[model samples]
Target chain A: MTDPSRLALVPFVSVADMMRLVHHIGLETVLTELAAEIEADFRRWESFDKTPRVASHSDVGVIELMPTSDGSFYGFKYVNGHPKNMKEGLQTVTAFGLLADVSTGYPVLLSEMTILTALRTAATSAMAAKHLAPKNATTLAIIGNGAQSEFQALAFKAVNGITEVRLYDIDRSATEKCARNLAGKGLTVVPCRSAEEAIEGAQIITTCTADKQYATILSDNMVGRGVHINAIGGDCPGKTELARAILDRSDIFVEYPPQTRVEGEIQQLDADHPVKELWQVITGAVPGRADADAITLFDGVGFAIEDFSALRYVHGRLRDSGHFLELDMIADPDEPRDLFGMLMRAG
Target chain B: MTDPSRLALVPFVSVADMMRLVHHIGLETVLTELAAEIEADFRRWESFDKTPRVASHSDVGVIELMPTSDGSFYGFKYVNGHPKNMKEGLQTVTAFGLLADVSTGYPVLLSEMTILTALRTAATSAMAAKHLAPKNATTLAIIGNGAQSEFQALAFKAVNGITEVRLYDIDRSATEKCARNLAGKGLTVVPCRSAEEAIEGAQIITTCTADKQYATILSDNMVGRGVHINAIGGDCPGKTELARAILDRSDIFVEYPPQTRVEGEIQQLDADHPVKELWQVITGAVPGRADADAITLFDGVGFAIEDFSALRYVHGRLRDSGHFLELDMIADPDEPRDLFGMLMRAG
Candidate 1:
């Protein structure tokens, strides 16, 4: 058999390779770069082909396919959310993504997105905080200290100049683990005994719990004036982390209203609730923070465009990083119409 | 860093491995097995979750994700169709697929579906012909001698006892190439100059042209009584292969009504066209071929359940075939909640 052609091979980044690339470029740098890419894409969000994720729900969890295109390139992520997986020693969320050329419809890159989703989620949160949070804010309060807590802390520190992160989880060991992981990450990590203690002096609050129910990690009374709340954990229908009272008191900003209205914290509110699109705020079409005393909430259900931005960022790094394997995923017959001839010759 | 757990490893079958596996199992046996599997799935089609493919269309081509599940396992195929690619020495279609365990939402198998799609499509066509075609049908006329022609011919031979295949393509070289590739195959191959000559004395007429636009590959006058028409090329919107008159004269059977009404030859007909569901025919809910003189047309725009069945078939072969590579595609942290700690440990 002849060697497969260049078009037959797609660069694939494994989990170890992704970790190596992150450590090689420095996680803070990757997060900052991802934020820049996401911000740039968000600034021109109209150029994208956007749709709500296609989801398949089951008794245990949900599997979703999020796809988007920018006319020149197409990308999609296959992600699963199984909260019950953790008890069986499996990550609650696991994902992988692919990027393809729009002209030829051939995949160019495939990568493990479990780690990248963490980084992109954090980067997206921090990027939103840069615009919605109070100017010169330094402290961030993380309501759930699980797999995503440390990445969120580092992303805020790297992208928003955050100097401290207060972590709190129902399980004390989770908070301790988060603090231990962020020991030398150039920020002060505080393991708080309760969510109230964690949000005492924090100007930015991010909630990313793994519960699959409508549990209020933040209530109306606990939140103060002039604070930005990044609600990311309420990413599916029937799952939210913020109380209805808290949402009513805050000015809400969201990524893709059609999706956020069903999956974000805003799902608890009326369908006709007025909320600003984050892209509009980024593009200067809408104001982000109304006043120094006004509360702002970013209801973030992860969108496909963010994943496209992250995959594009990773694709650009492949040339210099050499952190991918070329898999013979596509069949390239020498004579385009002679695929059977190629197979017969191989035999 | 510790080695990735077994949960992180996904079995990936590449193009070469797929070719090798086909040869190892013998093409005829594989096609017969695939036909049986597709037949079994079609019998229980109501048990599967079905949806039309999610497609991203461009001026030049389309890329699609087809997903389905049978409650126990979930599967999806990522496929592309760029008719212009053949002019640039690339296959007009390429595909890959993944099968995941529904309980955990973890991928178990990823395989190159370009060859497998060809096989499954042919198997599907032959399986459909089994119920619709005249008894003892021995000759097949393939109208478009492209990448899928030979597979269709062989599958008909293996599953429907087709002893001769008449091949015709607008480009005569494509027919010559197909004939040369099927030289030593059990069936006799004949090259014809036009579609009219190809269908003469043939019992099963298979149309699989590569045109992205609607073309009258077969007209009403050319198709005779008692012959089963397997139209597989009219797979996308605005890409019908047969003339509208032919569709009006035949009793059409379709995989899925909503999708076929938009993508198959039935697109040129009414929205409420009288067509029998192929699964209903397979399950004996509907009668197939009312009489020997009745004209039966199978409007086959491939469905997700067929791909799901194909992926499941390939996955079952993996236990003894050993023609796959283990890919570290999933991130498996020792503590499910400590993904950041796993990354830090990797560093």
Candidate 2:
């Protein structure tokens, strides 16, 4: 254990501990609660210092830093995506983040965000569906079944009452694994041969494929009218999955517009294309879907605000469960400026 | 303490512990070692993916994110500067940073840098001075005597063999505090009444005023020939201290050109003005001080590379000392994708 004499503590939640929280809370409940927290944060969106994430791209993959702050709290996430990682026995994405107190610039929590990212993405998709999807929506078409597919399925089941799910992926084993892992979850999971077959009659369509380049996973002809699409794969520059015709016909919503214009599905469109921010839709400042026939899309590139919400949620939940580890991320000193002295006294 | 099974550990050094390290290892050794590390990292500069820092300016202060990667390792620092913090009984600057593995994106070290920052800044300045300052230089004029002043005084004495220091600050109490802090340091201390008194006959002039606006602390006429000026205070946009004439007359060196152009003393000059990056000089690619009588300037806006160096130093020093605490910052799992399952197993 760290020195108890320290002035502050940074609670760390490892992957194992995070999964325990998920299992105890249940996947559906965690997603629903996360959505509620996200909605609450969005309702007071004006309080945050918002910006699009900063990204550094390399030939192999992209690494990004997403930071945001309210007057009282600060949060940032370090995340990377390398589609080739799976071939190397690694996940496609890995993330970690910090929640800090603005008053003293001290971190309160540090957490592994790999699993949290999946959960937040699912929760965010479900949150977007609360506004865009039809009230009678009960079925979801999950294209590109992978690590995130099960979480998305469970999130939809919790937030949108989605009871039926059709899964499809280029790799049949991935879809089968997703189905097997999600067994006895009280949902009907149907394996489909292709993306077109998966979206046959579903009201909510989520595409979370792990492709580093542009591949048209969904063309305009295959996507039906009024279907709410959560496009999670097309999240980097020059990497999009949907055809321009589909974006042109849909009502697009984004986390942050300036970022979406550069890195989201909206990158496929012109600069002047109008889109509503999800915060605006969540806060009722803008319309989501005006009619039953309105095709709505949530171009999910992931935002710092969602990570902020996720970090805060995990910090709170760990406290409730009394399962946390103290980290020596910050120094505690009797005299703040005597940093040199602190070291001398360590022994 | 964190979970022992987690592969990555977060080792933190507090201000007091850092001081203890300095006292134990000796200040001279720390500066010498830090300089070597900084120089080593810069030698293979092409390996690093570097970017100008992203800064968020508030009414009272500025917070910034500085990130860099060398394919194998990644590092970033979260720092803030508010001159008014002292009035509120706080340090003028507070910082923390992380070093991570690029391949796995796991943090290996998390450190409190408020004290380390002061050390690294001084080490960097002394490193630059060793190249730029004339041979047989033995005196330094420090123009700011705030919390960082004592560190600067000690670092210069340790790294450069300075035997005398002239201290000056706008606040007399701060100057007195610095004098008291450095009383038994084996150097002659002169408390000066004015900036003119401080610079007289000094081989090196270090300015570290804590103003966030453009305030001239040195004039061209006041600075004599052959003086190596360490410009440490001017780091944010619209916040510069060097007169235009001094810059026009001196041979300037910087940490990162892209960043120094925007936030360093060079921010006041035209974009086309010539300047040498410190790395180029350190690596023998460019000339630093051409002659003994030529005025030299080191525009010191703290860089991520330096923090990376400092993190490496602290991590090495604390290993056997056991002054650090392990944190659950990385999520290591038997099944990487089963983040939720890891937590469940922990329970």
Candidate 3:
């Protein structure tokens, strides 16, 4: 191999570049491509390295770093969740990620995942719903109507042919905001007064409430048979929304079994509760939705592979469109051994 | 908090910006400011959130993520050590780091620390040496003089006022490289045949060999009274240089006791072997060196806080010079509630 130091530094995709990519490719296309990449990566699940995230919890919130590498590529996401942030006029969850070459440990791209995260989360929901939800599903009831509600609504529209969305939030303004964001998206938006009203007769019930407690947004009787439940918000030890009765009645699916056991809707379920990993469903190694009457629950807690796929998707789009700036994040010493030369030259 | 959505997007500084900061401030000034920041951060040690680094080890190398936060700001370093990398014409160690806001979870700066790590490691050594070494120290012995030797020499110059450096390495070319790198720095660089020849009468001794196994570089008799030892290279399990007799005879100081007990030169010694944390010395809670006859050993296994301080210093310097590029690493929704709009509109 040629000297690694002699290789030209890789181009970095900054947040601005990522936004430009969205503008150039169109947001719908970005989500479409990102979803496709995630699906492809998930299908070849055995080809990557996986690990449970390392989390540091504080009284106000939790900070986590999710890392995974596919032997050749390494990706990690740094995210924070502070329920009180919204009260202080901050978003409840915020994140960013990095993509690097495993061989050299040099970052190849850094993209803004805050918006991308919403896109991916929604895409992931839609992706799971594709396999788990009944075909020809039309309406999605998004109970939370917060930052993630819009993405969830549109992703279902693009993937599952959903033409209608029922939005409900404790704060009416949040529900109004969701409707307004989805106004021109060619989907019918319904404003609901209560979570029950939103979930009533909906084919796909997405529970994304922000409460960091075990509050049942969907009870056992309210969730009917053949309805797909995309549980998005409850993702911590003390935080979960689905009642145990609801979980026991549904055929559950999870992103990673080890992680989902702790952070997904299954947190309320017993350890012995049989669940299928999403990858297994995608790979056809396990069955998804044994019968139409069997209610399917996609216990989505997000995963590192999704971020890796999102990063890879964004990197390709950003690089092709010339939307990024070159970050001198790596020191290019003429002689890698003479790192002191950089200092001497600086002096 | 103007609409919270408008402020959600965070700014990112790239590596190019960090190099500009170095160009604008000069390396010595940067190192001095960095050392001062490290000292300040150490003084307030209890206010920060600390965690032991997470490392992924491979047969030929090890990659680690060291993360920490001070309630408000978060930092993490991605570093790798492959002693064989140099032979493949790559630096034995390469690193990059990030600094972010804890409130918004936005990355503010990304910097190349492969070179800066050497500087910070040297700065950390000098800081410990200042507190532990005998007063008015001059001659210094640097065993295993490789890529890190020049920085060690200069940092000692900046902090300990050492005028002469004795260099010895198993690879003759590495010692020659060290000598070449320090030729005109005004310090007398003497190339020696062995560790014994290098430390015959030195007041300060620094060992930084790169072997992965336990190799005794220094025994009891070779180390004399009042000689402060900066043990830098033996930083992982199954990797240590100093014999047990040397540790038994010395007054050892460490960065963090829990971490040092696992990864430091003291790994060869008993678990309950008494040691002093560097922060305690900085806070004046613990004594450094009692007298001229006392032998003080700084088992430097590299700490997360030093990386935190270094990243903070780099962020401040780069921000001041306007060299940092704004990476749209943070997602900014015009209306925080309209995150879906940002993505949908892009599509």
Candidate 4:
């Protein structure tokens, strides 16, 4: 138990705790709720203060801090992307995040965002698909059956009523692993031999292959009209999934232009390329899925507010469940100015 | 005990653990070591990647993220300053930090930085005083005897061999509190009735008052020749301690001019006011303290590398001491790309 008098205790949700929380709430239910929370926050986009993530790049990988605030709460995620880590039995991406009271600037929650980031990223993609995908879209072609594959499959089904999923990865074992995981999830799961087979009869195609270069997972000829392409793999500079001609044919929508221009599939286009903002689309200020034949691409690079929403959702659920631990992260003195005295007395 | 797996488990220095670590090592020794560590990092300033801290300001206070890297290691501190917090029995400034291996992009340590930040700030001030203060200076007048007063008093003794301290605050109880804490510390401790009396014979006037606005704790006429003014409290924008005329009279040195111009005492000076970089002085690339009659001022705003050095020092100490807890912060799976599979199997 932590002392109540001191402000040292912060509630922390570990990865194990996160898995338990998801099961307790039902994974599909969690995804559906997260999508709703993200949509709600997006509607109030004007209220948020956003900035491009602050990154430190090295020869091997990059570490970034993504922060945002909405007058009452402040949140940030500490995430790293090291594509080569997977070779050493380490995750290519790992993350954690914190949410604090804007009034006090004291963290209320510390959470492992590795699992949560995949969840929220999928949630954001599903939320965008709900607005931009064809009205009766049911099949999802998930190209790249890696860490993010199953979540993307589940989230699309939960939020957008996706009933069929075709999977493809360069590694056959990856495709089989994703298929095995989705066996009893009430979806028509297909393990495709190639990318061409994955997109057959699929109105929604999500490409999430883990590559650190500008390799085209989907060329222009593969994409048909009126399909929603959720490109999730190409999220860093020099890393992209779609060819330039495919992006040219699709009506691009983005989370934040300044960020997407540098990181998303839109990086292939000119800086001045006209793309619709996702938040504006959510708020009904702009059109989505225009005229049913224009290929709408949610050039989703992900954003800070989506993570904020996910954290807020998880924090709200912690009280009903007991999967969190108290962390002694802050220093509170009997007399706030007697910091040295606190140390002296501790001695 | 924590489960040791392929996943990296960052050792966390909790507030209680930090207190124990300080007692185990002795606070004076910690201060002395921190000063040396800060000085060593300062000498290699050109090799460091420095940025003006990213700040998020609210009506109540400000929260900042300070990050620095030296090729092999990356470190960042999340800190908040809310003056109104003191009225509610909370420390005005609270902080936490993380250090990660740059090669792997994995956090190696997580620490409660409230105590460490105080230690580093004082060590930095004492480090600056070591070069800028008049040689053989013995007495220090600590204006605003609050949370930082005792540490400032001890750091000077540890780093620069100060033999006496005179304390003053608007609240006489604060002055009494500081003097009581310093009792029998092998130094002469004096509790003064006013700021003027506090600086009577002191050669170093350390102003560390906690005020949110531009209010002078030390006026122009109060300053004397050859005294090194360690102006600390004037850190954030609009909060200053020394009068403008005093800034003009003293030769000022700062950390990161881009940041100092916005947050330090030099904020009141001209946009291009000439000031010596502390790193240059420490590296012997620039001269420090022109002469005995010339007043030299260390306009310390604190820097990221100082916190990085403090964290590095603590990380080195953790291996030798048992005052740390392993945090299950990272999610590691046997299959690096099987995040969802791990969750599914956790059931």
DockQ for all models: 0.86, 0.36, 0.42, 0.79
Clashing pairs in 3: A15-B328, A26-B346, A26-B347, A27-B346, A27-B347, A28-B347, A328-B15, A328-B16, A329-B15
User: For model 4 chain A, where is the 10-residue window of minimal lDDT?
Assistant: A1-10
Model 2 alpha-carbon miss at residue A160, Å: 1.0
lDDT (CA) per prediction: 0.94, 0.81, 0.81, 0.91
Give, for candidate 2 chain A, the lowest lDDT window spanning 10 residues.
A336-345
Candidate 1 lDDT tens digits, A1-347: 98999989999999999999999899999999999999999999999999899888888998899999998999999999999999999989999999999999999999999999999999999999999999999999999998899999999999999999999999899999999999988999888999999998999999999999999899889999999999999999989999899999999999999999989999999999999999999999999999988899999999999999999999999988998999999999999988888788787
Candidate 2 residue-wise lDDT, B40-116, digit = tens = 88777777888888876667777788888888777888887777766655556878888876775556777778778
Q: Judged by lDDT relative to the true structure, which candidate is superior, 3 or 4?
A: 4
The C-alpha stretches of model 2 lying farther than 4 A from their native spots are A1-6, A20-27, A272-274, A283-285, A315-321, A344-347, B1-25, B183-186, B219-221, B243-245, B270-274, B283-286, B313-323, B343-347
Badly placed stretches (over 4 Å) of model 4 are A1-6, B1-8
Give me the overall lDDT of model 3: 0.81
Candidate 4: residue A62 lDDT (0-100): 88
lDDT at position A66, candidate 2: 95
Give the per-residue lDDT digits (tens) of candidate 4, residues A251-330: 89999889999999988888999999999999999998886788989888779999999999999999987899899898
The Cα RMSD of model 2 versus the native structure comes to 3.3
**CAPRI-style quality class for the chain A–B interface of candidate 2:** acceptable
CAPRI rating of model 3: acceptable
Candidate 1 Cα lDDT to native: 0.94
- Residue by residue across B281-340, what tens digits does model 1's lDDT show? 999999999988888999999999999999999999997889999999999998999999
